[model samples]
Target chain A: MDVLRITFLRIVYSALLLAAVVVLNFVMIHLAPGDVADTIAQSMGGADAEILAQIRADYGLDQPFIVQLGQYIWKVLHFDLGSSYYYNRPVTELILERLPATLLLVITAQTLALVIGVVTGVFSARRPNGFLSHLVTIVAFFGHAAPVFWTGILLLIAFSLQIHWFPVGGMRDVTVTGGFWAHSFDVARHMVLPVFTLSTTFLALYSRLCRASMMETLGSDYVRTAKAKGLPMRSVVYKHALKNALSPVITLAGLQFSAVISGAVLVETVFSWPGLGTLAFQVIVARDTPTILGILFFSALIVIAGNLLTDLVQRLVDPRVRTGQ
Target chain B: MSFLLKVENLRIELRMRAGVAPVIDDLSFELAHGESISFVGESGCGKSMTALAIMGLLPEGIGRVASGKIWFDGEDLVAASPARLRHIRGNKIGMIFQEPMTSLNPVYSVGEQIAEVLREHQGLSRKAAWAEAIELLDAVRIPNPETRATAYPFEMSGGQRQRVMIAIALACKPKILIADEPTTALDVTVQAQIFDLLRDLRRQTGTSLIMITHDMGAVAEMAERMIVMYAGRKAEEGPVDKVIAHARHPYTQGLISCVPHLVAHLTEERQDLNEVPGIVPGLAEFGQGRCLFASRCARATERCLTTRPEEIAFSDVHRSACWHAEGM
Candidate 1:
């Protein structure tokens, strides 16, 4: 009963928070220095005064700000995000088309980075002064410090031009017509640079976070108790220390999930990946208000879901949290 | 037959910021099967480190058994290989720790934690090991063992957690059990209950026990023999009753006096805390070629300050390491 109540409360709280985010996002995007009227006129090829008024009426841009916000909120309730100015399509449909690509890119990057980072962190923490530990530290520092776009461009120059080992841009070659597996293989070949570019900063952050948390957990009294129980060092570390160490890492992963999607704008631009990241850039450039708001709403939902999952996983892994102590 | 456990000239050293320093210097003792011994000392007196060294659980790259032999069941533990040590550790020698709150892993249920040791050491299947774990919890007298078996450490009280710690340590019925201040963090009532539980369990299992604690009362209640440790070295050792009656070392004298005996001092008066003067010296003063306790000893002389004391026997079983042992 308590679990059900808490979960219900959490969902209601999230819904309320998301509604506020909707209003806040609408206001903040409006506050930014961009004229939807001007963008529409420019795209419609220098519309005269009469045509400008008609464009405003067409996009509902001439409505009062309060009325527009209420109408937008009402449309959100009905799953109608209006239509993009440049694409001339429902904003939801446009976002959904790009959603799969962005999801693929972000999930692959997150999984790859997390696996590599956490494994490296565990090994590095096991032998603090070992060569692998030192190498990981140096690499993580550089990875975190370097810009994602710069990393992407560097990978493109080296792998695509210098070595000819990978595709330069886009997901799969347009000329390589093949079966499903073959096409996927080609797309994977092209994803190397963008995923690598997007994952570097997160990988570095997780490795450093896991390393520090592991070190602390390794020294905790429970770990010493495990060691004293005469269990092998392997069991002592992996079974006893790792789970406790991972809670903070899980939290960092949750926070990074949404940030990674936003950060993909930079890396996706460099690689010209046909993902939401690329569409996001184009929409912002075109001042496509509905598309921009749609992406923001979707990203906010993803962040909330990620955070909820992290909390649930933490409860599962940590008995203290599960029992509410 | 040889003693079930014996430590001869056991020395433990730590690599500190200054240099290598002895934390446990020239300590020796023997435990017959089913016998109980206690090492009583203040904090930083190396009681816990001695226990860790015996179990081969000393902190890696920092603390090590610098020299001497820890003979256990016809094996020299100090020279034992890693594989041999692991074979003996949880299988033949179990250990419980001080902090009940922090000793058990928060991620694991008490049952699973106990079952892990049993499975690892005894090679029992998961189902059998789990059954044995519930039995162990029941043996330790945890209420409703079936329900409590699935409960996490956070769900249990301090006394109950210490009981779980005992259950884990005693799961494999090791020949020797070392409990390092297992009940210190518990409340007074819980402390006595844990002590009673340990006494009942030991009586039943016949496991030779080495309890390391700073509480003289705990030593008096739990141990057959007691060794007074001061600054990493043995100050005095003998049968607990004999040593308590006639403590040869001044440090032991100070410790016993510090504990108030209510039966003898029945007057309702606000008594001052009778803590011993000064404190235990750090590792820097461990090998200073003088008695580590001489600074605090009321009977220190030129010889006491210039030379370290050696163990001088007062009886077949009792010994004290002080120049004035004979007089005292």
Candidate 2:
């Protein structure tokens, strides 16, 4: 009963938060310089004032700020993200079309980063001053220092230009004629560089964080007690210390999930992957107000869902949290 | 008779940024089968470190047994391989620490933590271990063993947590249990309850105990033999009643006087704390040839500064390491 109540409250809270997020994104984008009318006029080779006014009127940009924001919120509540100014299609339809690729890329990259980071972190933590530990630290330093785009370009140069082991860009081969398996293989090949590029920074963060957390937890009194219990060192570390150490890492991962989505913009643009990140980049450049707002709203929902999942996982793993203490 | 556990000239050194230093200077003691002993000392006197060293759980790359022969059941623990030591640690020897709150992994329930030991050492099936865990909880005097079994460490009070720790330590029914100031972090009333529980458990199981504490009152109640430690060295060792009644070392004498309830006169009348005057010397000053307690000793003589005193026997079981022992 309590769990049901708390979950219901959480959903209601998320709904309210989403509404606020929509309003905030609308206000911030309005405050930024340039509007869809200006971009449209510029695209039409510099329109006169009459044409600019007509474009503004056509897109409802000429309406009062409060009236526009009210209408937008009402439409959002009705599941109608206004049609894209550039694409002339429903903003939701465009985002939906691109959502799957982004989800696949983000989820894959995150899982890869988390798994590699935690494994290496646990390995490094076992012998903190060992050669392998130092190597992990050095690699994490390099991962954090390099920019995502630079890493992407470097992987492109190495894997595509020099060796031709994988495709240069995009998600799948246009020339591929086979069915699902071939298409998937082609997509997977194309994804290797982009996923690696996007996940490097997160991987670096998780590994370093997990290492530090593991070291501290290993020193905790309970770990010592576990050792005193004559538990083999393996159980003493992995079973006793790792769970406590992971809570913080999981929390950071959840917070960073949104950043990963934003980070996808650079990776997607670099690799020309057909994801929301590419759509977002194009929409920003085109000043497609409805599409931009739609993307932000969806990203907010994804991040909120990610946080909820993290909380649920933490509750499952940590009894303290399970008991709501 | 062969002793159940014995330590001969045990020395523990701590590696620090500056250099290595002896934290536990040449120390020796013995625990007979089912014999309860207490190591009483102020902080940094190597009481807990001795326990850690015995369990082979010293701070990694920091605290190491410099030289020692910790003989347990005819096996020299210092020479024991890591695997051998690990086998002996929770099977033959159990340990509980001071901070009950932090000493338990918060993620696991009290029952699970207890079950873990049974599973690890006894190789009990998961269901069997879990059943044994609830029984252990009940044995430790925790109320509602069934429901409380699923309760996490945070849900329990400090006393209850300590009881859980005790349950975990005693789960495998090890030959010896090392309790390093187990009750220090609990409330005064809770402290007495925990001690009662320990005494009852020890009596039922006949498990020898090595209690490390500074509370003289607790020492008198919980231990038959007490070794008062000063600066990582045994300052006095004897029957608790004899030593507390006729304390030859100034440090031990001061410690006993500090406990108001133990001193009948002080319990009736309010007074300022009867505390030992100086602090336990730091690691840098340890292992010096001179008496580490000299600076703080009220009866220190010139000889105390030049050479450390050796253990001088007052009786068959009572001993003190002070140049002024004879006079005292």
Candidate 3:
């Protein structure tokens, strides 16, 4: 029952957040210096006045701002995102085609970062004065401070150029057919560099978060009580301490998912992974309003959904949260 | 007569920023089979540390047993291997801590937490352990054991949580139970209820108990014998009634006098309550050569500052560590 309520609330929150994103997108596009007609004309080496007017009428760009926004929202409710002017495809179709690559990259990277970060954090916290703890802290500090692009470039240079181990750029080798296994393997291989680069920062951030949370949990009287009960050191650290510590980390992981998806724009461009980042980049350069707005709506949905999932997990793990406010 | 637990010259040295010194110096006591002993002292007097040392659960980097022998059921716990210690802990010697609110894991249901000890120590099946958990909870007099068993620590009140802690400690029916300030965080009403429950449990199971606290009232209520500690050393030891009625050590006298007595009618002359004049001396400040509480001693003399007072016996059962003990 509590799980149901949590899911219901998440859906409502997602809907409200999505509505706000749509409104912001409309305001941004409308407030810009030029309309889609003008942008198209500029791209096509300047269209005549008649052609511009015709294009304006065709796309309903001649309507008032409020009327256009209302119509756009209504169309979105009916699952119609309109067609991309440059791509000459439905906006939803365009988003769908690129989303898998982005999803594949971000999810893999985030999962890897969470696992490695949490484990390292737990170990570091357990043996606080050990050599490994010092080493982890030092690495994590640099990983968090360094830029993703710089790290990506350095990794590319080392793994792709210097050592000649992995491919220099792109999701896959040219010779590999885009079959399920072949494409996935190619993507996975190419993902190592960019994902590793992106995850270095995430790893650092999460480890720091985990360490702080773990320390607080360790200091909690219950942990001391558990120790007093004479439970083995392993059980005390992992079962009693780590479980409580991960609650905040879980929440952070959910919030970070959205940030990672959004932040991947820069990293994706660097590695040329053909994800939403590249698509968004192209749409921005071409000033393609539909495609850009579509990606914004989609990303906003992902953020809302991620947060909702986090809430559900929290409820499951912690009964107090569910029973309380 | 077999002794369930014994501590002989148990000196626990804490390495602080200043230097190393004994937190529990030459503290010796024994809990005979089914006997209940209470260690009473003010805060930071090392009562809790003594309990932790017996359980072998001292916090990291704070303290170590400098020199001691903790014998539990013929086994030297201080010298036991980690693997051997694991077998003894929770299985043979269970412990309940103070602050019931924080003693149980917040994430898990109370039943699951109790059952975990059963499964870990006794190797009970999940179903059997859970059944036993509810039964133990019922034994602790927790209402609606079946339903409350599923409740998390946060859902339960302070009293209920303490009961659950008691349930967990007794899950394996260990020979000895160590309760460190078990009811200190509770209210007066709840404190009485918990004390009653502990007494009832002791009667039913005949398990030896070592209750550590700063409350002399609790000692009077529950303990058969009591040990009073000052500056990490035993100041007085005797039957609980004798220690309360005729405290030999000045520190013990001060502690007993501080407790408000109804017999002393409220008057203007009694307005000022009895209070110890000084704080506990820093372990580093008092070296191994001299008495630890000499500076704070109202009866201290030249000899008191230079020489550590050895335990002087008033009787075979009652003893005190003080040069002025005879005069007192």
Candidate 4:
């Protein structure tokens, strides 16, 4: 019951914040030096003043700022995010179409990174002074410090250009036809380079964080107790130490979900994956107000939703946290 | 007499950057079936290290048992294979640690933790292990055993957690139990309760116990025989009451005097609480001279500093290591 209340409160708070941000975005764009009128005038090769006025009225650009914002908010509340001027489709439809591709890439990459990172971290922590641990530390340092775009380019050069292992860019081959499986496989195939690129940075960070947390937990008294009980070293590391270590990792992963999506914008645009990231970039460049606002709202929702899910997962993993909440 | 555990000439050395001698030298002791003995010492006297070495759970890359023979039930534990050692630990030799709050895995339920030991040692099914876990919890006198078993370690109080630890250690009814300051962190009442529980357990199962502690009160209450350690070497050993009443070793005398007695007249002239003067010598560059305690001993002489005192027998059961043992 309390959880329901908290969730409801969070939703309301997020809605108000997102509404404020959208209004601020509208105000900032209006205050910019150029306008849609000027852009249309330049594109039309010195159109007459009367024709320009007609074009502005037709696009509702001549409306008062308050009237424009109120109409946008009402449409948004009614689940109608208006048609995109550039894409020639509803903004919602465009975003929805690209959502699946981005979700597939981000979710798969995050899951893979978490699994591999956590396992390596636990192992490294258990053998702090071992060669494997030192090697992992060095690799993680490089992975964290290196730029994601640079890493992506390097992987592209190595895997695509040299080995000819994967496609260089884009979501899928134009020839792939029919059904869900084929589309998914095609999308996944094209996702290889970009996912790997985005995951490298997160993988390094998660591993380093897990290793540090695990190392600290391994020195804790419970670990000693487990050892004293004569549990096998494997059990001690995985069952005892790893569980506690994951709490911090969960928090980091939650925060990183937002970062991953934001970072994905650059990667998606570079790779041309047709995800929200690419749509967002294109929409912002075109200054298509509805499309830009739709993407902003969705990004905010993803971040807030990701954190909420993390909270729920943490509650499941640790009962003490549930009671505290 | 048949002994269940015997540790002979156990020497632990710190692997120093520069050359250094062993930290724990020629330590020897034996535990007969159902007997409880304690190794009492000041902090950093290598008491806990001795326990860790026995358990084969020493910290990585620092200390090693240079030479020793740890015999458990005719088996040489020091030379035992890792697999064999794993079987012996928690099965034949259960151990309870000092801090109960940190000693239990917070993620697992108390019952699950206890069941882990049962499943590991007894090869019981999870269901059977859990059933045994509840019984063990009940034996430990924890209220609402069923509910408490489902609770995490962090949800319980310190004393309750310690009780749960004891319950888990005794789950398999191991032949020997090593309790390293098991009740040190508890209040007086809780300490007495734990001691009583241990005593009851010993009486019921004839489980031999090796308790490591610096508390004289704990020693007097629980152990039948006591080995007084200073600077990682045995300074005295005897029946607990006899040793407490008439300590031959000067260090033992100082420790006994330091124990606050209820008799006001007996403690009215107490002066040596802080007067023991020097701190325990560091393991690095420690002397191999006549007496490890000679530097702190008020009765030290040229002979004390020149030649190490041998273990001298006061009786068949009482022994002291001091040059002036006869006079003292």
Candidate 5:
């Protein structure tokens, strides 16, 4: 009953946050120096002044600010996000087409990073001063400190270019038409580098967070009590210490999820992957207001959902946090 | 052979960057089967460290048994392997710490916490452990064991949590129990209740207890034998009544007199409080040549400054580590 109420409250909070983000995003896009009119005419190789004015009015850009804002909000409420200025297609359809690809990369990368981070984290905590622990810390330190692009480019050069172990770019070979499994296998193979680059950087963050959190929990009074109970070291660390340590790690995961969405834009652009990240980059360059706002709206939901998941998970794992005590 | 636990010339050192400092220096004691012993002293006097050393729960990379023999169940614990030590720790010797709040994992239900020990040490199945846990909670006199079983640590009061801690500690029915100031964090009324519960449990189980506290009232009531610790060394040790009535060391006498006696008249002017004036020296001064308590001892002489005092036997059961022991 308590958890249910808290979760309901969180949903309400997330809705409010989403509403605020939407309004802010809409206002900021309008307040920027240029608009879709300029980019549209620029692509048309400098249209006549009268034609530029016609295009601006055609897209409702000439409406009063409040009128435009109301129309946009009402359109969104009716699930009819406006068409992309660049693609000249409905924004929803375009985003839906690209959503799965980005999710595939982000989810697969996030899952891989989180699992390895948590595992190596607990392992390093178990043997804090050992050679394995030391090696993990040093590597994670450099991995985290280095730029994500630097890490991606390095892996591309070494693994893809040098050894020729994986493909260089794109989801799969465009010409190689195949069955479901065959297509998925090809995509999975292509995923090796981008996913590796994405996962390793955050894997470093998770490991460091896990190690530090685990170390702190390891010194807790309950851990001492567990030891005095004659529990084996494995039970002491895993059953007793890991749950407490994972609390902070879970919160970090939420921040990482939203952070990774934006991060993916850069990596996707580099890899030429056909995902929402790539879509976001292209739309932003074209000053395509509808498509960009639609992407921002989706990103905001993902972040809100990520935060809600962690809050629920944290409450589930720790009764103290759940009861609000 | 009649003794359940024995320690001889035990020395524990904290390895510091500058030098090794002995926290417990050349301490020796013994506990007969089903007997209760108490170590009473001010904070940082190494009473708790001795408890940790015996339980093999000393902080890693910091504290180590420099030299000692903790003999229990025909095994020298100081020389015991990690595997052997694990076997001995919870199965034969149980320990409860000072604070009840932090001593329990807040995430676990109190019943689950108790059942955990039984499952680990006794190899009881989960169902049996849960049933036995409720029974143990009942034994500790916790009200409504069934409902309280599912309650988390935050749900319980201070005395109740300590009862849960004791329930966990005593679940395996170990031959010995080490309670490090188990009631210090509780209120005075709760303290009495916990003490009573401990006495009742000990009587029923016949488990030898090693109570570490600075509370003289607890020592006088619950302990049969008491060791007075001063600056990490035993100042005077004897039967509890003997030490309280005829304390040979000035530090011990000061500690005893400092507590306001209840028998004094309510109308009479309160006696000026007695205090042993200096502080317990830091780790750097541990195991030094002079008497560690000499600066605060009313009986201190020039000899007390230069030469460390050896144990002076008053009887087979009583002894004092003070140069002017007989005169006092």
Candidate 6:
């Protein structure tokens, strides 16, 4: 019952957060120098004053800022994000078309990063001064220092350009004519580079965090007590220490969800993958305010959802959270 | 051979940045079946380190038994393999720590923590182990054993957590139980209760206890024999009542007088409380050629500063290591 109430409260909190995100995003997009009107006329090879006015009036840009904000909020409440001037399609439809690919990429990378980080972290924490642990620390240090896009370009150069082991860009072979398995294999091959690039920085962070957290937990009085209980070393480390250590990592992963989404924009643009990231990049260049606002809203929603999932998992794993204390 | 546990000329070394120091210096003691012994000393006097050494739970890469043997039921623990030692720990021997609050995994239910021991040592099914855990909680006198079984350590009071720790330590009914200042973190009243519970449990289970404590009152109450340790060496050893009444070593006497006797406090005018001055020597000062406690001993003589005092036998069970033991 307590968990239910807390989750319900979180949902309510998320709704308020989404509203703020929408308003803030709307205001910020308007604050930028160019809007859809300027981009449209510029694309038309510099329109006359009347043509510019017609374009502004046509897309409701001629309205007052307050009036535009109110209409936008009303449209958002009705599950509408206005129409994209550049794409000549509804913003919601465009986002929906791209959302699945981004979700697949982000979720896959996140899961891979978390799993690899935790395993490597546990190994490093076991013998903190060992050669392998030192190697992990060095690798993590390098991973942290390199930016995501830079890492992507490097991997792209090495794996795709030199070895030709994987595809250079996009999510799959355009001419694939096999069944689900073959298609999936092709997609998986294509994902290797982008996903690896996206996960590297986060993987480094999580592993380092988990390593530190696990080391501290291993030294905790309780872990000693567990060992004294004649438990096998395996049980002492994993069953007793890992759960406590993972708590902080899980929290960090949730908080970093927004960064990961932003990171996807860069990775997707670099790879030319058909995702919201690429859509976001194109829309921003075109100053598509409606599409930009739509993407921001969805990104905020995903991040909020990610945080909620983390909270629920924390409650499941730690009873202290369940009691709402 | 008849003793449940025996330590012969034990020397434990701690590796420090500067050098290695013998933290537990040539200590020897024994525990018979169902007997209780207490090691009384101030913090950093190696009382807890002795207990950790016995359980083979010493700080890794730092503390190690440099020499001597820990004989438990005819096995030399110092020579035991890690796997064998693990089997002996919590199965043949169990231990409770000083801080109960941090000595339990905060994420697990206390019952689950207790159950883990049963499952690990006894190889009981999960359900059976869980049931046994509830019984253990009840045995420790935790209220509402049924509901409390699912409560995490954070939900419990310090005293209650200590009880849970005791329950975990005693879960397998090991032949020996080493309690490292188990009640120090509790309130005085709660401390009494825990001691009573420990005594009752020891009596019921016939488990030999080695209680590590700094409290003279606790030593008097919980131990049949008491060893007063100073600077990692046994300063005095005897029956608790005999030593408390006729403390031979200056350090032992200081420990005894440090506690304010209730009867004396009630009967006489209050005067300045008696206290032992100075501190336990640092690691660098340990295992010197001369007596380690000489700098702090009021009865220190010129000889005491230059020569380490050997144990002077007073009886079969009583001994004092001090130059002035004959006069005292």
For candidate 3, write residues A24-87 as lDDT tens digits.
Answer: 9979977888767877899789999999999989988888889989988998999999889879
Considering just chain B, what TM-score does every model have?
A: 0.97, 0.96, 0.96, 0.95, 0.98, 0.97
Specify the highest-DockQ model's number. Answer: 6
**Residue A258, model 2: Cα distance from true site in angstroms:** 1.4
DockQ of each two-chain model: 0.77, 0.83, 0.68, 0.75, 0.82, 0.88
lDDT of 6 by residue, A1-325 (tens): 8778888999999999999999999988888787777888887788888988888888888999999999999999999999987898999999999999999999999999899999999999999999878988998999889988899999999999999998999997879988999999999998989999999889999999999999999999999999898888999999999999999999999998888899999999889889999998898999988899999999999999999999999888877777667
Candidate 5 interface RMSD to the true structure:
0.8
What local lDDT does model 5 show for residue A55?
Answer: 92
TM-scores for all candidates? 0.96, 0.94, 0.96, 0.95, 0.96, 0.98
Q: Judge candidate 3 at residue A277 and give its lDDT.
A: 94
Model 4: per-residue Cα lDDT at residue B182: 93
lDDT of 6 at B66: 96
Ranking by TM-score: 6, 1, 5, 3, 4, 2
Off by over 4 Å in 2: A30-65, B261-274
Candidate 2 lDDT by residue in tens digits, B159-228: 9999999999899999999999988898899999999999999999999999999888888899999999
Give the Å error, residue B122, model 4: 0.8
Indicate the docking level reached by candidate 2: high
Runs of candidate 3 with Cα error greater than 4 angstroms are A47-51, A177-180, B263-272
Q: Give per-residue lDDT, candidate 6, residue A146.
A: 94
B143-171, model 4: which lDDT tens digit per residue?
A: 99988899998788889999999987888
Question: lDDT values of the candidates?
Answer: 0.90, 0.91, 0.86, 0.86, 0.90, 0.91
Clashes of each: 0, 0, 0, 1, 0, 0
**Tens digits of per-residue lDDT for model 1, B5-109:** 989999899999999889999999999999999999899999999988988888889999889999998889999998788888777898988998998898888
Instruction: Report the C-alpha lDDT of model 6 over B207-315, residue by residue, as the tens digit.
Output: 9999999988888889999999988899999999999889889998888778875554566776566998888899899899788888888788899989989999999
Q: What is model 3's native contact fraction?
A: 0.70
Worst 10 residues of 2 chain B by lDDT: B260-269
Candidate 4 vs. truth: CA RMSD?
2.3
- Model 1: runs farther than 4 Å from truth? A1-8, B263-273
